[model samples]
Target: MSILADVGAFALKLVLILALVGAIVTLVARGARSRGDDQPAPLEIRALHEQLRERAERIRLETASPAQRKALRKTLKRKRKDEDKAPGGQKERPRAFVLDFEGDLRASAVSALREEISALLLVAGSGDEIVLRLESPGGMVHGYGLAASQLARIGKRGIRLTVTVDKVAASGGYMMACVADRIVAAPFAVIGSIGVVMQMPNFHRLLKRKEIDFELLTAGEHKRTLTLFGENSDAARSKALEELEDTHTLFKDFIRDHRPQLDVDTVANGEHWFGTRAAELKLVDELMTSDDYLMQRMETHDLFGVRLRQPRPLMQRLAERVSMAVQRVREAALLRA
Candidate 1:
């Protein structure tokens, strides 16, 4: 009788757990269906000016005396009234739209970036500025190339574009950064690597030792310059090197065309520098963080942050959550061990 009671209790708990999981999954599925394939992702816009003002007001409330706060409120009220009374066109302040691109090896953020730029270009005029806080350590050549082209669109429209890097913007990242009218970086930010690199490991010798065979066939003479599983001939290696040099030359030409002041030959050596050194080398225009530049611009411009939020499928979200949970469990087990 005691054994039977214990088994019954375990079964009850299992049923409850299963029921809870079922409910959660049903809710997630409903959410996914509601945001079906036909619906477009939403555009999220944030008024940086109002956000900064609220933050400052909060700090002032904690640090300032009552009299000081009262005076500040009155000053703000008077300024608002004056602006309200100003002439229609004269009261319009120049706008600054902010976009953030946190890139990976594929420059995947370009998906959202292209959308954000298109939306901004619709309303942004010559008087408006676009501030892109770009952070990328570099990635695939074609991916970053597309991103650089998107930034070029702003310049073509006669709108000012500013790129700010607080961390690293080497290799292909610098490719995108150079398209901006102004490039700003933090004091210690890594900048520049105006060269191309390609590397792969050959397993031909290992396969030979293991008595394995690998074959690659191509119609064109130079179609396959190098291969991982096949023996590489001297001519193939030379051709690969020649291709890399060609890419490097193109990279240098792009930089020279954009920033003619810099001697491209001197700095296109696959080396990176901190922001200050980069400024001296003319790799970057200024040594300032994105935050500082935006704050200063906010004084004269109405700043806004723009983003496009795409919803993921229910299964994808669940899979990501499960992965995170598994990682946490492994970490906890390691700590216990």
Candidate 2:
């Protein structure tokens, strides 16, 4: 009877372990499957006004006296009553939708930017404005070009678009900034690198030295103008230069069309400048950080920070919790040992 009871207990433990393993496997598989879905995540909009007010209230509570806090509350109440009694009965204030784009080499943030913009366009009017706090050192031509085009959509709809750069907006970053109706930057922000650049290291010589052969085949004459593994001819090099020149020309034209006052020739020489110089050169309209600009706007306009967040799948969330639980168990065992 004792042996049978021990066997039963061991079998039950094995069954429970198998069930947990099977559940984890199922969850991991579902998480992987969900990743391939093309549905975009929902946009998350945060009211900057409320956030600022809450922060101020916290500070006041910590430092201000009870009488001061009471007086402030009364002031706010009276102000709200006055607004409610106004001509239109609490007139709607102009809104300023804020977005942040921290770019990478591929401008991956553009995916979220596009979604945020699309959501805003549905509700935003001409009186309302879109403020983009852009930070990028610039990258690929096509990537930033698409990002710039997305910004242009706001203006096309007659909505005001303002871009603020607190750090840098060089090359492709400047490309997107130029699309804004107004460009604001901090005093020491790096701005402007209106140029096209292409570079790659060729292994042809290295392969030759290593006694290795590499072959490249193409159908079109310019299909493979420059390649990593093949010997580059002068013709190919010249063709590549021509392509670069054409892209640069397009970039210049785009900037000129948006900022007619800019001397595209002077600034499009692959040179960057501080915000002070950039303002003088007409590359930027104002020398102000995003924080200052947004705060100023917050007084007269309702500012909302817009973002799109992809929620983790249920299975993914469960997996993460399970991983954390396992980590805790391991730590517990280590401590006991």
Best by the TM-score measure: 1
Whole-model alpha-carbon lDDT for candidate 2 = 0.89
Pairs with backbone N, CA or C atoms under 3 Å apart (clashes), candidate 1: none
How far out, in Å, is residue 180 in model 2?
0.8
**Each prediction's number of clashing residue pairs:** 0, 0
Show model 2 residue runs off by greater than 4 Å: 1-32, 35-39, 77-88, 311-337
lDDT of model 1 at position 146: 95
Candidate 1 vs. truth: CA RMSD? Answer: 4.5
Tens-place lDDT per residue, model 1, 114-216, is 9999999999999999999989999899999999999999999999999999998999999999999999999999999888999899999999999999989
Q: Compose the digit string of candidate 2's lDDT tens values, residues 198-302.
A: 999999999999999998888989898999999999999999999999999999999999999899999999999999999999999999989999999999999
What's the distance in Å from true for residue 224, model 1? 0.9
TM-score of each: 0.86, 0.82
Position 43, candidate 2: lDDT: 76
The TM-score of candidate 2 is: 0.82
